[model samples]
Target: MILSPYLILLIPVLYLIGWIYWFLKHKRPSLNMPRIISFHKISNTPELGGTFNTVKQFESFIRFLKMNGYKTARIDKILAEPEEKEILIFFDDAYENIYNEAFPIMKECGLTGVLCPVAGYIGKKNLWDRGLKRFRHMNENQLKEMSEAGFEIISHSMSHSDMRRLNKESLIKETTESKRTLENLLNKKIDYFIYPFGLYNENVKNAVKNAGYRAAFASYNEKNDKIDSFAIGRNTMYIIDSKFDLKIILERKPLFLFGHEDQKGRIINWFSRFSAVIKI
Candidate 1:
């Protein structure tokens, strides 16, 4: 595919504007406060969908974080110590691949991750999603072992439905019952919530807060005016991301330094919106 002359000429203009925007934004005290990265699967599965990271990529990224003096911590710790090199690692969907692959790697680095599993899908394959490469969600035993090993297991949702489209009664159950389900299974308090598909509104946030979750996380799609713990946003990690892409993502990097791959990430993230339309 070749770019048209008009589109080609317009690219630099867009970057110039984006650069100005980036400069003004970062010139302040700093806008890269909540540095959280969310991952789906941690396997070398073959698929057109670039969701899972290979074991090698996962290990390299973790090694890069350690080399840069970063430590994985809970969201609460990250918030309390704002200036520290603390990051929150999230393994959304709680796939068995994550337990089999990412768990040991993180342990080797003396870091832990927060696991957000769909309460109803535990011990079952991800039939709710629209994909050819279906994967299994961690069973109760796998989840329990990780929780005992110091990984935090929290609610992704009861059935992993879109919260923005649910009714009041269904909304309440998704937030409240899911937490109850996980707490009973893990025998520990489930404090935080990660919105399925990263979709939520005021009602969703209120429901989560009322459900006894001290904080909740949204994906990159939802932009917040400030860091609202109930609606905090997290960066998503894709298969194509490299160490340099991760650097630009960790900080609100300069415009001139932002590369084409980073721009591709922004475009790819648009696919997340498809979740509202389909099970994917």
Candidate 2:
């Protein structure tokens, strides 16, 4: 069926309006700063009630990053640097599956990564209270083994709660106590900290610095030319079954850049909700 002239004319106008609306809503200056992309948690058993990354998929991501000229630095090394690189991998919540499955493969590939653990959750119950299912925080023996084998063990948090939502006392305890615990366990200094849930505020950053942390990782994915050295950004790689998604992540310069200064998860959560609505 042929469309009427009036209907056809309105289509272009509608398209233009939609485009303008999207542009304004998402508008922000493109950040051309150096970036360091990384993945968190490579386990066969899920944590926090989330699905686990298959061994195959984890391997594929490592291979992809290596081919693209990304290097895995200990969290301390990355934080000590003046600028970030194209790729940097950090594993959150040092689970046994990483040592059992992913570690061997990563060594074979000659890739290094930072392992950030919740020091209080190693032998304790799930501190996040997300329910019990394969809680795999590394014990002292495992931590010692991994530390000797060249994996950098760092701090995630004491209890893995959102830092921005915590009080000053809780924040201090989370930062200082976790560092002390990990240092005592591994017999090494814990300099790098990964914020639980990638959540933080200025107060949190100050607390981390005061606690003697050299660097901290946030969930914000953006080029960090002018990023606060204490509060660096990291990108999360999800367990998707598409090479195209990988390609997009690798090719795009600002795909992970954050637009809001205060709300770290706002942009990502909006996209997640939108994708669900559109069935993408």
Candidate 3:
């Protein structure tokens, strides 16, 4: 095939146009500080969960965080003053594989993470993900072992139900009961809560706060000029994500990171004003 001279000349022009678009789109006067991130199921298998990352990938990702000098979530991670390059890592759905697979890697990397588990389902299979694969939660003994190893254990919920779909009574039960159960089992204060499926509303956030949690995690760090600890949003890690994706997220310099979602995100933002009941 003969290359056309006109096409060759247009290549650099197109590249410049793409670069300019990205530069403007990702330009932020200030970045979101003290990063908060979430991950789940550090396994080699993909069928376990959508965010299931391979063990090798997990190790590499943690190493990158450590290289950048990101701090692990200590007891006062939320209340303390933000250190240089601050970050908090959260692991959801307390799969036993995390204890077996991720714990050692974290220890080797000299890092830690908060593990969120369904309080009522400790030592039992994840009934919520029963349709995927039969994965067990870390038993009480395992939970204690990880705690002794210096990993924080927090409440996911009683049964991992969507908080937005629950009534006020049910929402309270889910948040408060789970915290009570974990505290009783671990014999320590459970300070944080992560909403299941990344679903929440003002009511749900109020319930989490009333339940004695210092903070709660939801999915996607949308624009929150005033950061509310109760509904603190997080970016979900998927099996397909790369080192570049991790870099953009941790640095809070999203250039080409979310470029594919630009169109869809704009459409949603356009209708957001009209949808009084829907909260992003």
**For candidate 3, lDDT tens digit of each residue in 146-257?**
9888888888889777678889999989998999888888899998888777678889888998888888776644443445566665555667677777777766555444
Candidate 3 TM-score to native: 0.78
lDDT of 1 by residue, 168-268 (tens): 99989998889989999999999989888777889998899888898888774233235667777666778888888888767645535543433455566
Candidate 3 backbone overlaps, count: 0
Rank candidates by TM-score, best first: 1, 3, 2
Please name the candidate that would achieve the greatest lDDT relative to the true structure: 1
Best-to-worst order by lDDT is 1, 3, 2
lDDT of 2 by residue, 1-280 (tens): 9999999999878756754543365443234422455554465554332324677888887777667766665554444452433445567677666677778888887776677778878844343424235356767787788788888887998887768888999999999999999998888888878887666779998999999988777765333335666667654555543344555444543333232221323344344334323421
Cα lDDT for residue 262, candidate 1? 37
TM-score of each: 0.87, 0.72, 0.78
Two-way lDDT contest, 1 vs 3, winner:
1
Q: List pairs with backbone clashes in candidate 3.
A: none
lDDT of 1 at 10: 100
Q: lDDT at 95 for candidate 3?
A: 87
Q: lDDT for each of the candidates?
A: 0.78, 0.64, 0.72
